[model samples]
Target: MRKIYNSYINNFTGLSKEIWLLSLVTFVNRAGAMVIPFLSLYLVNDRCFSMPDVGWIMTSYGLGSLTGTWIGGRLTDKIGFYKVITLSLFFGGLGFIGLQWLDSFAGFCIGIFTLILIADAYRPAIYVASDVYSKPENKTRSIALIRLAINLGFSIGPLIGGMIIASIDYSSLFWIDGISCVIASIGLFVLLKPKEKDKIDPDSSIKKEGLPPLLNKLYILLFIIMVLTSITFVQYFSVMPLYWAKEHFLSEDLIGWLMFVNGAIIVIFEMPLVGYLERINISKTMATFWGGVFIALSFIVINITSWSGVLIIGMLLLTLGEMIGSPFSSALALEMAPKGRKGSYMGLFSMSFSISHIFGHNGGMNLADTYGFDTTWWIMVGVLIIVSILTIWLYKLLKKSPTFEGT
Candidate 1:
């Protein structure tokens, strides 16, 4: 037992202090991520918006995320990840505060759009920073550590957000979230200094040489798979809470606990699990396939059981799938990116989730609203099955390419 514990500790210890600081910043920021998880429920239940309206609003947030990452990627290459991350955290925090005053649909749309656009720009910058700071062999574990921080924060956020909602109004969610972001930004501003290599000039000839990530054929296929997988995965935020409340009559506190379970499971298992998988030389492609299959199974099991015990089991499966798939996908993107364009590649990769949110929320809500939850789950199963096939094909194709020869 001691030997195993020592090995796990060594995996984290091998990383740079910069990586640990970045993870701390992520943890602080995500710790206050109270708004989005409850956004759909607040819109539909509190604001009395229709399901379709909620979908459109959520889609608008996605649009902002897409645009944010695109610009952020370019900015990271041009300016530096440090400045980009600092500005994003500080300004996005202000956006969250601004959201508290908005009540009309147009106001909500504009507010959500602005907040996500500024806030999500942090994603690619952080990933690029991680890649820049870590040794090549530690890249995957570095990303996992950051994810661990995220999940740990998430484990706290929703559980507390649930209590806040139960006792007070929704406005508190925005305030707390905004406050957290500001504190994180301050911590980052004081502690995070960019290394010389990370300070690439925008107009430098080397920075401009590589093809844009979107134009790469292999990356495009991977992006498509990302969208498909995220469509199923993102429903946890968009629809699952509403399902628990309306369909099962669960309280907000209970729903919060459910979200907590998702985050907590990842916190406990993600690093060690990812380390084990990578150590075994599991192909990123196969890991993704198995993860997607488990994700699909999670939904299928939910459809089959109403018991809380079974529901908790289903949530565990969903988190396990996330632990398996999400970090590896980012690591794979890092592996495939050209040397000078890590920011662009990571940006496009991050956009995959935003695109998923756009379609998944709108589409999933439409299905649940029209055909019911059972139909939605079955359709997700079908989507995952198709995505799994594509993932396998992508793996085979990559194997044939000289660039991806040994992968």
Candidate 2:
């Protein structure tokens, strides 16, 4: 146990001071975010919310996230990254605490919206901070380490949530989540040191060569992909447990453990793999990763039998694919960003997921209700396959285009 803890601590040696600070923030924020996976369950099962009502509540959170991302990006540019991060943490932690007091539907909506608003605000600042702090050679790894910290936090959060929910009331989950944010807030405040300001390259010919406008096109394509992929990812939160409960006779305890397993695998392996992949052709690697997601999702489409062990195996595959796509897409978005517009650029990337959640969470529930989980999974698989093909096509097109920035 001591050796394991030491290994985890030593992982930071490869990262710079700012990157380490960002990692701490990511871990804590994600630890707080674990409340989301079981949030639907809390609403419907615990609070007796109707399906449509749950949709609206989640939609409100997504809408708030959209606004928050824009605001966060704008603030980071004018004020600075550390201020934005600190404010986000303080307010976000308050929002989590607020969840404990929310009993009515309106109260739930308000609480969730506030939480997402603050939480989403942290994203762009962290990204821009990573970009500012690291040299080009380590930029991708810095981002990956940030993600790894979040995933590691995610790994622990759900397991802890599971144990807490099993033993206590669902409301207790909020307190656990809120406290994590507070602890992380302290760490972030102490660790983040401002370095030299990163100014956009005014003389860089790329903006003049049409790179700025090209991002809008990539934005559209990526949005479609995000909507499709998020439908599958949201299942881990929204509908999958219900499906297993209704169709597979799986207990909530087992479901929680499965979710924990998903996070644990990512925590253990996502970084090493990302570090390795950073040295290779990122676009091609992501295309292949999405292909794997398509195949892993097919297991659900073709799923007719009930086997807990097999389901776990399928989840491992899905997570493997997710790990590949997450960091690759983030780096791509960072690369696509125009100078001085890092916030909006990151805002656009953040918005993709928010928009996707609007569809993926609420729309996914509707789809699962109208069709079955099996059919829903098939729809997701088909879209993922399409995304993989399109990503590859885009890669080829960018390679040939004279306007492409990063080779």
Provide the lowest-lDDT 10-residue window in model 1. Answer: 196-205
Clashing pairs in 2: none
Tell me model 2's lDDT, rounded to 2 decimals: 0.71
In model 1, which runs have C-alpha deviations exceeding 4 angstroms? 197-210
Tens digits of per-residue lDDT for model 2, 330-349: 77677766676776677767
The collision pairs in model 1 are none
Measured against the true structure, the TM-scores of the candidates, in listed sequence, are 0.96, 0.87
- Candidate 2 regions with alpha-carbon error over 4 angstroms: 1-14, 195-215, 282-302, 403-407
